[model samples]
Target: MVSYEGINNARPKTWATAADEWHALAKYSLDAAKDLREYGAKPLKDNWTDEVGATAAAEFAKLADQLEAAYDILLSVNMVADGMTTTIETAHSTMRAAVDLATQYGLEIGVDGTVTGPPPRSRTEAEEMGPYRAQVQDLVDQAVEQVTAADRLAAAEFAELAGQTGLTDPGKALNDLQTHASHVQMQMLANDIPVDEDPTTVRQWWNGLTDRQRKDMMLAQPVALANLDGIPADVRRELRGNGKYDRVKVVEYALANWDKGDPTDFGNNCTNFVSNALLHAGMKEKTSIWGTSDDDSWMIGNRTGVDGVDKRLAYSDSWAAAENNQNFMLEHGGSEVPRSDVKPGDII
Candidate 1:
């Protein structure tokens, strides 16, 4: 029979660590229980004592139950830890990408002499600031999208693994993963080390724009106005009236106006507009928009005649695994976008 005393003494320091240990223990327990059953049955031919046989049978049954419980705990702990690891790795990658981008754009240093390696260099002259700010903002926006995508992938994988492990209650496993991922993401956002661009500086620069300059900038990009169907009518109107909206303001508008109908239904018009804006600004063709909802439309869909098709809906039941389907979009150039190089339709 399996040794209950040994098993009880083998408890781990933490639930996750314990789960790992019990996973191995559970397999060993099952093997031991099987051996005991076989040995007990073989002695039937000898007509063993009733008390001894009953004890053996009861012990084996108890071991089997214990093994099953241990297996469940193992699955739950693994799922939670896996989710946490994925989120942490994704956040680190995003921060690195942003920093790299900033360095490329010459924004590697702050006015106070602090090193901010990845953003583009600041444009000292007012005339040179707008485009430079826009470029930097675009890179930041892309980084945010990538981070969000990573979060979603982590969540989905955790859920799938939990189901595969034959856990008695997979819902708890999924919830734990979600909580862990959220906590990691929140920590990353809170740090705000300014990898690609500084939010405060960008805001100040935007506030300095002249009405005419803003109007000219707004009028230059027909793509954003025409294609962003997901944008609210009022916000779209505001954008149309003055092209000088700051990068953050535009993103805020997009987020605020996001349609909630379908979780994965990336709205057609608005996504295209955002994608096109990035393309015009020299962002790589693979750059995508990332968000939690179905309609947030980054680059995961198939395009037809310059418009993206709803592949999720079109192939609902036949969807490929996420890892096999979507290519991770890494930042191409350095973090900061220079003001002079900023295209009118640029996202940031």
Candidate 2:
């Protein structure tokens, strides 16, 4: 068992407090300059004509400018620190939740972030734990990914800021950020379930999934479609759901509601719009590979959820995001075609 209590809190809230103090110091510097000009320099200028007084007043003005610049930098620092803290904390929360779920299912996470379990002595026990083990493993993997993503995002943002402010060698900082970004990109590329794998191999794996496991995972992890290979092309074509589809209607509905989905309300809903278009084109919603709930296999709800407010049209990120949409299309009898070959109603 791992004690997830204090892996990292992004240096606690102490940094934020320190930032407040720096802000106050900046203000004090500005106020002091103001007082020197008002009660000291201005009075000297009014009463006595001297180069020394003029120089002192000019210096006070310079001091005030420096103070304001310092304030701006300190504020930027505070914002960056706060943002990174929030990101790391969110990662910690997600990691903790994953660990808890794994533990609940009798799984243990090794220090390396791999998942293990209580040794199963019997065939029945092994069989029963199979699906659960996969789920726990998935959760652990996700937790690791969340942490990595948080680190990369923070690092990249910091590098950008540093480069902009010339605080560090911009080239070096940007190179480091690029390395981190590339690593993430490569990880994702390596994990992608190649669509070109043999249909037979894909089918065997798909067939091995228990019916309930299939439904649960499809709803819970649509990304699996993008990462797991070995389902017959025809099966993937059905989108794990049974339905008739009219690509023309899909296109028509999309054109009709071109600006309807609120981009501000949800993350870009292009995929969600495509999914709805398929539905409008007459693809039936199936629980196994289709649904409208936040965690359903595939769906964007008809309306946004707002308390005491009239319902507004809404959609799910999975249904609307490109990657998931591409997975859905590939699994459900769609394939990539050449740009020149595409017809007006065809989905890209």
Candidate 3:
């Protein structure tokens, strides 16, 4: 749990800086060990066949490999440090803002993250402080959630990154070391996300993350995240890589443009908003085929009016109505999933 006083006094950047220094030193040592292998060990093993020279070269190679394993451990430590720094900074700032808001609204917050109503002279004043106190409590809770999640994730990551095990193959000794860095990055993303499936909550979680944190999650589990709603279009694009219709982009665009339609949609309607997002994400549009019933096709037709500044828009029911759009997508290779299987980008 995060407290007001803890948030005020915590220095996450200091921890991150210390970790970086240690990483730099470890990298330097790793480079030196590599140098030993190349210049000291390899040359001796290649040219000196005598028993003493060969034994010394073998020892140099073994010591260099051990140094590499240590370096790998330090590399994982630096990764965790950076992740913790971002998490702590975000939580601290969130808690501080809550406190500031409480002060602005005539509420009092204690060091233990308890929000209290202001001393009101009248019943009306007391009633007015209720919302302010609630807001402060929300922020405090958010900070605690963020920090507690980080604490749990960091513990697991440290254990995995620094675990010692028996090594049977000398050649495979560096394999675990080589893979730890990327695995540690994925571990950094194993945080507590909201289970309520609120789009706003999910988006807030995504936005609060640092770039490295975002990228690591993106690279580690792009497909799963691509299905997550509330992620931005560009990140989803990077996740998909291919030029297919991105479900993440579709959801993002629909939510952002629901009330007011963009030029691409040309209709200030809910179905139009969703269709625009689908088209923008590379879903092909269908034209009128049979008679021009709104349900006969799924397409947006735009035209210029006599007054050039004024434009007119045409749409089929499938493109402008919710029920029709649902039917259209269902007929076009989309299957409905159970609530437990719902992803961020699901149409529902």
Candidate 2: tens digits of C-alpha lDDT, residues 215-247: 433433343452446645553443433436744
Per-residue lDDT tens digits for candidate 3, residues 26-143, read: 7986897799899989999999989999999998887777666666666667767776776677666556567677778877878787898647889898787776677667667777
Winning model by lDDT:
3
Best by TM-score: 3
User: Which ranges in model 3 have alpha carbons more than 4 Å from their true place?
Assistant: 119-131, 159-244, 247-348
User: What TM-score quantifies how close candidate 3 is to the native fold?
Assistant: 0.55
Tens-place lDDT digits, model 1, residues 1-348: 212122223222353454366457546645654664566544542455488776766665555444444444454444444333333333334334434545665654232222333333564554464554455444344334434444455456556544544333334433554345444443333222222344443233223334543343244433343344433355346553333333434443444444433323344444433443333334433322432123323333442423234434332211222322222222222234678655433344
Distance (Å) between predicted and true CA of 319, model 3? 32
Error of 2 at 106 (Å): 0.5
Deviation from native of the Cα of residue 5 in model 2, angstroms: 10
Q: Roughly what TM-score does model 1 have, to 2 decimal places?
A: 0.30
